[model samples]
Target chain A: DAGITQSPRHKVTETGTPVTLRCHQTENHRYMYWYRQDPGHGLRLIHYSYGVKDTDKGEVSDGYSVSRSKTEDFLLTLESATSSQTSVYFCAITQLLAGGRNEQFFGPGTRLTVL
Target chain B: DQQVKQNSPSLSVQEGRISILNCDYTNSMFDYFLWYKKYPAEGPTFLISISSIKDKNEDGRFTVFLNKSAKHLSLHIVPSQPGDSAVYFCAARIFGASGTYKYIFGTGTRLKVLA
Candidate 1:
């Protein structure tokens, strides 16, 4: 909700197919993160970018890839979509709050279903 | 293995009453902890946080208490309202080898404040 938007609020894809979710921000923040939320698992980071053209893997990076070519956009791509990858994806940007600590603000979310 | 764990799956509390959410972490290296609140179809929002140096932190209606010896933290909401009904997730940060901090989240506990 903090100047962040994620495209395709709801998406349905088939297994073995590829899916890419887009995250765009107007804040021009330096950090962007991709995460997935499942029923049992809260939210697991898929990838994060510290700056443009710079990215790093998270705990659950398998079957997922990320690209950040521009300062305002970060993309998450599932090379081969699987049922296990079906979850609500969220994009977040980090900023330093008044408390002098970094806090993350998230986009609404994109619900991806793989059948 | 889950480094951060929230044992309660769900909790129901009446309006104007108090609600308590608990979280535990296994990683001793984690010195900072945060609490996030998520509504349906929305992204998780930062709530309150406590550092290892402080045993408690309070912000208006929400309070976070930390116990270093027990490696546990609890969120307390006084006079819980229906609007407060949502899922809460606990997160922990561990310094990564890449010089960037990585956050690990718990499974989450759904809170339903009855009107």
Candidate 2:
């Protein structure tokens, strides 16, 4: 386990409502990522943070924004929730193994339903 | 365009059989590949991974095989068990802008191991 946790295990909200999801990591790893899982698209990257206050957009970052104020916390916000935005969001941290190869450890995930 | 693709959406295998899941990628620059197994309503867990320099990496019953020329990789689970049933995803690590490496994931293939 990478000591990753996501808030709001399940939620239901109306369209246009704003929502925020939090990811907390106890490992203090330098790299953190947010991804969404959809039935046909699989897991699509939404955003990532290389360090505190350093963030980058992922392929599917159109309606989402992210922030990292501390090494242990990363937050993802949906400015206006849409039906298309409903998904299971995952948080992950990268870990380097002895062979110099890296792998990501994921959180429990948050299921959001936009009505 | 999707750089990583898992053409098969589902597969079924008899218990104590071998289960193979395939993934294809378009980019040759991907330096690392990983496989993740996810159960319903839970986060994905790392199954196994292979570096670009190696053709195969095995961990117990899970083995990952990479073909650099074909940009293809596959996960082989030997002596499949009922507990091995889950949605499997393949991800490739690519160097993105700002010296950050991003993971591109396939749509996933659901494996159902029958008893």
Candidate 3:
């Protein structure tokens, strides 16, 4: 909850529909990450951005896309939502500190349900 | 395949007792490990982290022990408090080809501190 906020705290959507989740940070951190949490899968990173316009895939990048247009905003878009994607989504921000310490701060989270 | 695994799905410990949560990783390239605590409806917050070069790291009543040879890590909380009851996640960081680190998280262990 450190200076991070996720939009649409809860959402109910239909399968095959497109959905976009927003993450805003006031901390001005350089790195932002999108993750999904499920019952058996703790938290799987979907994508992360190191800087504006610089994004990369994560372990579970399939069926998800991300964009960072500004330093404070990172967006995660589900091009075609699926029932398998129904999970709690979280956004986290982090800055590289001295000695290579990277501690991420997370938003409250967005619960998305795909029917 | 899951690189990080937390076999225990839930754990309960009495107040003033020690609670130990364990995690194992299959990847040897991981350079750092971290612990995060999550509440019912909130995003995860960073609790502690340890570099691969270190065997143990401690802060206040929480201590993390890493065994590189066994590919195991454990978090120990002394005098567990009700406030400490939550889902604990274990994550491992590996350096990516893009010069950034990617994190892989375990399924998580839910800890309940009985009052």
Candidate 4:
């Protein structure tokens, strides 16, 4: 929904290798976010961008970094893949509506496996 | 530790019955709460939301009830259908020290609606 799409929907990388996931949106929404989903952990935010080049870290940003050099693109990079980082990654966009309330729309997702 | 919590890991319901999912939060300052539904191999989709100022919000067969005092929230789906089976996530939005809004999410609750 929200015209969001994620690249390389499935990937497998070895330990110590680097991997980057791409998130693309066509709606031009102002907020973009990266999150990882694991069993019993729900969805944990890794990073979010309010505008181009205005990215900030989330609670689970320890092993991940993000960049948003354009309005439609947000990327997440794992410096070195680890087994603990093996999870399904999701990209989301928050539509800030009137009255300062907002709702988030998400992309299909990317499944990453680190061995 | 997670700020948002969904204690129940899974639930099973009969078709045409009401399915109730519960969520709790440790942070009382969250002003906005939302519920999202996710199917296998897909990202989550926004379902409904309730503001801290309001205790209840409804949209057709789905209703969200909030108790600010107890820091609890629940989602109700009437006449549950087989397609209604999915993982539900509760998200809480709170303003951060940097003046930006941050969302905290619960682990998730999987609901199985039997035909």
Task: Write one digit per residue (lDDT tens) for candidate 4, span B60-115.
Answer: 99999999889899999998999999999999998766667779999999999999
Docking class of 3: high
Query: For candidate 4 chain A, which ten residues in a row score worst on lDDT?
Result: A93-102
Which scores greater on TM-score, model 3 or model 4?
4
DockQ of every predicted complex: 0.84, 0.92, 0.86, 0.84
Instruction: Please give the range of 10 consecutive residues that has the lowest summed lDDT in model 3 chain B.
Output: B94-103
- lDDT tens per residue, model 1, A1-115: 6799999899999999999999999988998999999889889999998899888899899999999999999999999999999899999998856754667889999999999
Tens digits of per-residue lDDT, candidate 2, B1-115, equal 9999999999999999999999999988899999999999889999899999999999999999999999999999998999999999999998778788889999999999999
**Chain A: TM-score in each model:** 0.95, 0.96, 0.96, 0.98
Model 4 chain B: which ten-residue window has the lowest total lDDT? Answer: B94-103
User: What docking grade does candidate 1 earn?
Assistant: high
Candidates ranked, most accurate by TM-score first: 2, 4, 3, 1
- Return the top candidate by DockQ: 2
Q: Candidate 3 — which residues are off by over 4 angstroms?
A: none
lDDT per residue (tens digit) for residues A1-115 in model 3: 6689999899999999999999999978888999999998899999999899999999899999999989999999999999999999999987677897778788999999999
State each model's CA lDDT, in order.
0.92, 0.95, 0.93, 0.93
Model 3 chain A weakest lDDT span, ten residues long: A93-102
Model 4, position B40: C-alpha lDDT score? 93
Q: Model 3, B1-115: lDDT tens per residue?
A: 9999999999999999999999999999999899999999989989999999999999999999999999999999998999999999999988776887778899999999999
TM-score of each: 0.95, 0.98, 0.97, 0.97
